[model samples]
Target: MESMEPGTVRPGGRTARVRTAVLQAAGDILAERGYSHLDLADIARRAGVGKTTVYRRWGTVTGLVADLLADMAEQSLPRTETGSLLGDLKANARLVQRTLADSRQGPLFKAVIAAATGEARTAEALRHFYDVRVDEWAPCVQQAIDRGEVPEGTDTHEVIRAVSAPLYYRLLAGGGRIDVAAADRAAEAAATAARAGVFLSEGRPR
Candidate 1:
């Protein structure tokens, strides 16, 4: 069979299956050994697919990692609605904290973040991954504005990022514990700031 080109979208059928298996293998290898140890042939073997298939479809390990991040963004859980901005944000924070605190996911994210620090393409892909997640949660912030819980003209995306930033900082720093208290504090800070217009387009509370 002819091999698909790198970066092509294969959403269903046999091609989808191949893409799924290859990405799964790529993720496993990434989680286990980080990006430096990811090899096309090794991933193909682990995924039980032809090396040519993975090579043709992804072109390089960076490409494979980029695709994996894209798929992760696509698979991310939808925002939770709790009828209040703080409640919604707390849910978001806890979700981020849990993912970062998970043994497998923690190391995997650390590996990807470290790789992105040195590789420009990986960095762009990682940015895209965060963009997708932020976009997903931004609507909840907008809802807060609609409810008058937050002031008008606030940056919804920024507010959402605020909710997750401290949790990510703790995860990356390894200097502080990321527990339920930390998550709640992060959410509360963002919510408080949003209500105070700290996330306004002007970037300061009026």
Candidate 2:
């Protein structure tokens, strides 16, 4: 498929096509070349779009990464309501597992992490990605609270963050395999933490 310019609007006025093309190209370059080598001109050339257009739309590398992260947030899997915290967390774990295991996404994330280590804006973009994901999954934790599985005033965002932390640790730290077992472990740990009120009100001690 022919890639369109970053700011090009389609005849039908759909932005999805252009957004997808730009994100896909950005991901490809990040995975193939790493962050230091990521130039807007090179990305535009690879994406078959005008450099001016890419720059006009995403003024800097940081802006492009931020937009890319937003695109990822929009495409993230919807939260699963499975009646229990364990089930919900397991569903979330599986989703993370699948995303990090994908050939392209895995390397792209590694590149992003590597970039974030040295670039403040890239780190901010990475934080934004997690914030969006945390918000998306927070409702599941709230559901558990409503169901009386977790304590009232439990920190839903923290619980959700916990579920994905170990998985990301495995991916980024090379601690262990990112598999179904790891997913299950992550879910179990997060559920246990929630039950123990580890994420409770500030005054509450674990």
Candidate 3:
């Protein structure tokens, strides 16, 4: 028998329903309370599933959180192509800003981030989530390079990261507004930097 990893969602039917319910319950708890308050049994009760099922499927809280992060990445919106680098980056930044500013999503992210600080598994999951998102948007920078907007060899991944970093900082550390204006500014700054070769990879002549 193959060993299934915790939080790995099986395809449709009872298993899918169970996974959906359990993950939904977990997200609700994280949003309403926090990671410390997450209990498999409590989630099972909220999800209307058996405690043994939750325990067997997700043996630990970190495992459950990891699965939750995976689910989030899978459900995240696909990138928008607007025929230009700045337009695409602003779209990316605005998406990030809206998520961070969302009433439910904002708090949920804060809880996950705090949990990740002390938990290695959670931190890894968080990194993977961001990686998935970065991969989705990095192509825009490459497209810009093809069009001669940004310099050739501009680190596309870094440019994408720069667009979101200030937005995340506002959510986590800055305690400032994560608004459309801020999103536009982040996008503009990253675009300007990319054009200037600030995100060039090593050995690429500036």
Candidate 4:
């Protein structure tokens, strides 16, 4: 019966089971009906857990969403090591495209992003989730620098961010596709820009 806090993790045993069930239920509701429809009592019923437990553990809808986001960050796939900047970036882009195009995850992310606009707690949680993902993939750019593929002052994190930006735009906007071709184009654009010192610090190696 551990009380879960925003940005904190729960341990094993029944606590873990409860967390899993609750988060799954929360995600299902968010994906199907958006953030405004989330309720602790409904989530507890769907999860087959006690309403008292949900209330005591998460306390509020925002808290539960934060925990669900934390779980997603922890469960996200690891970065692939392809031994080349373009190869690594393409891998990253494809991962983003696939996740954003997924039937379940696509709507789930849309709900979260919409929730983030008006909810400070949800926005902070979403920021932390992207921060974790960016940190996970930034090393590939650094490795490129180490191998003389990019400028010494290249902003590695920015390059990583650029690779996924277009994919996300396509997801959020209604006019384009988030397909493999778009992913590859995004990755190539990032890799090319990194090589050309587009992400380098001002007055450094450009």
Q: What is candidate 1's lDDT per residue for 21-78, written digit by digit as tens?
A: 8887887777789889999999999989999988998999899989988887877777
Model 3, 112-167: lDDT tens per residue?
99999999999999999999989989999999999999898899999999998898
Clashing pairs in 3: none
Per-residue C-alpha lDDT of model 4 across residues 14-105, encoded as one tens digit per residue? 98989988998998899899999999999999999999999999999999999988888887878889999999999999888878887778
Clashes of each: 0, 0, 0, 0
TM-score ranking, high to low: 4, 3, 1, 2
Runs in model 4 lying further than 4 Å from the true structure: 1-11, 203-205
- Give stretches of model 1 more than 4 Å off: 1-12, 203-205
Deviation in Å, model 3, residue 47 alpha carbon:
1.1
Off by over 4 Å in 2: 1-16
lDDT of 2 by residue, 57-138 (tens): 8999888987887667655666888889999999888888877776767777888888889889888878887888788889
Error of 3 at 169 (Å): 0.8
Q: Tell me, by lDDT, which candidate is best.
A: 4
User: TM-score for each prediction?
Assistant: 0.90, 0.88, 0.93, 0.93
Worst 10 residues of 3 by lDDT: 1-10
Which residue pairs in model 4 clash with each other?
Answer: none
Please report, in order, the local distance difference test score of every candidate based on alpha carbons: 0.84, 0.79, 0.88, 0.89
Question: At residue 76, what lDDT does model 1 achieve?
Answer: 72
